[model samples]
Target: MARESFAIGTVRIRPGSARALELPITRLVTGADVTLPVRVVHGRDDGPTVWLDAAIHGDEVVGVDVIRQVMGSLDPKAFRGTLVAVPIVNVLGFMTGDRYLPDRRDLNRSFPGSARGSLAGRIAHLFMTEVVAKCEVGIDLHTGSDKRSNLPQVRADLDDPRTRELAEAFGAPVMLHAGIRDGSLRHAARERGAIVLVYEAGEPLRFDSYAVEAGVIGVRRVLATLGMTDEVSEPPARPSRECRSSGWVRARRTGILHLDARLGQEVADGERLGTLFDSFGKTLNAVYANRDGIVVGRTEAPLVNSGDAVVHIAS
Candidate 1:
């Protein structure tokens, strides 16, 4: 058998070898060109090519560590197919710890980007052309934003059998069937026939050990499930729960919030999840679940405004 080789931009990676390459995006104010860093691991054995990208939202940094750990564990000689790991997708936002690019556009919503478009759009287009389009599957990692913390969970279009299988194989604590949002990487990737899974966990800008561990393990499990590798570093400790729908429990009035329910905890419909109290200690309101489900996400910040989302329940 002949050795297989993969190409991304000007870099060529042969089977049983690995290479760290950069794809140039655009120039900054200081005339410095920004680039996307990519690590390509081309296994000797023939199999599927998968891409793992994290930190599309610069503040969502947990996935960066997850990808690092995952990359450390993979060996090209023993692995199958190709593994493309990109720890940071939004270079500008990541540099400044902002969720959006310098242009204030959400990178997650600028997929299938155009070369002549905005910064986010160009980056998205570059990613789609140089990375995502080269793979058969993808795993886009993310964390909750806006002071929110999410229980380790996989959100994907469960209607697609292949995608659903990968989601189940990911083994996050919970799986939510999410729809494709316009301009999202998930939406663009699927349109191009790549089975993708979006893993959400932890909180933006803050590291959670459990969420990080779950994410690392989930990516490996999905790799095993795809036959890209037979080795799974850590099997899921518990079975994953599935939900077809979810809604947020919002605050009725602005105040300091006291949450009673925890992530991954089951809650019944109308159960009190938390309370809001004004500065004067007056009870403002009590937040309750609208349906029976697991508490998948909640705000960690104590201060909130009226109608702020407090809890996310998947039923």
Candidate 2:
């Protein structure tokens, strides 16, 4: 079978191969060119086109490792369609070891952006035009923000059947039925009739081996589910659970926090999740769960202020 070709501006890509395309930039740094690196691998046969992107927040590098491992293991000859992998979308943020761009915009929150807007907006617009429009499905990878940690999980609106299926096939440790945020990649992809899954794991600026392995295997499972690759007879084990909703547990008073529970641990209503203590080791207050659920995320830093979110419980 003859392979199809992809043309994005002056860059031309042939099917059943991989290459890194440089996206032109103008706004992030004056006179400095920023490139959005993409790896396109199209199979020789017919199947669904899937886009796997990671590191939208530069510091969340777990997805980057996952994508790299998946890309390396895939055989184009065995694939049925195209797999576009963008390992690092926020080049500026990744370079500076930060989550947000130099302009202080959250790349994840700047989706379906404008070409004439800010740096993040333009990059988002470029991705929407060059990649999202050409793919049938997508998986956007992410992790917890600074000083926070998340268990391996998939966040999607389970109301959408396709999204639900992808989330399940991704095989994360948990699936959170999250609402779609405005200007998010998932929202933009859904608006364009493409089902996109958001996989969250580990923490920013650090790589968890378990999270990376899970993400890599999850991508492979999704590809197999989509008929892009053959299914493995024995896939890796996943430790995920489903949750209907999740919310943050905030600190009631300013003090140092000592967590009594860890991520993935179940908590009961009114159970002590943590304790706040004064500088002199005097107990100030005890933090309890208002509802029974699983601890999916929490702040790692011990310092806390009144109303600071210390933990996230999902039910």
Which is the leading candidate under TM-score? 1
What is the C-alpha lDDT profile of model 1 across 150-219, one tens digit per residue? 9999999888888888898899989999988999999999999999899999999977898899998899
lDDT values, one for every candidate: 0.92, 0.86
Q: Ten consecutive residues with minimal summed lDDT in candidate 1?
A: 230-239
Query: Distance from true position, residue 315, model 1, in Å?
Result: 0.1
How would you encode candidate 2's per-residue C-alpha lDDT over 151-236 as one tens digit per residue? Answer: 88999888888888878888887899999899899898889988888998888888889789888888888999998888955464
TM-score of every candidate relative to the true structure: 0.98, 0.95
- Point out where model 1 deviates above 4 Å: none
Best by lDDT: 1
The lDDT, on a scale of 0 to 1, for candidate 2 is 0.86
As for candidate 2, its clashing pairs are: 173-240
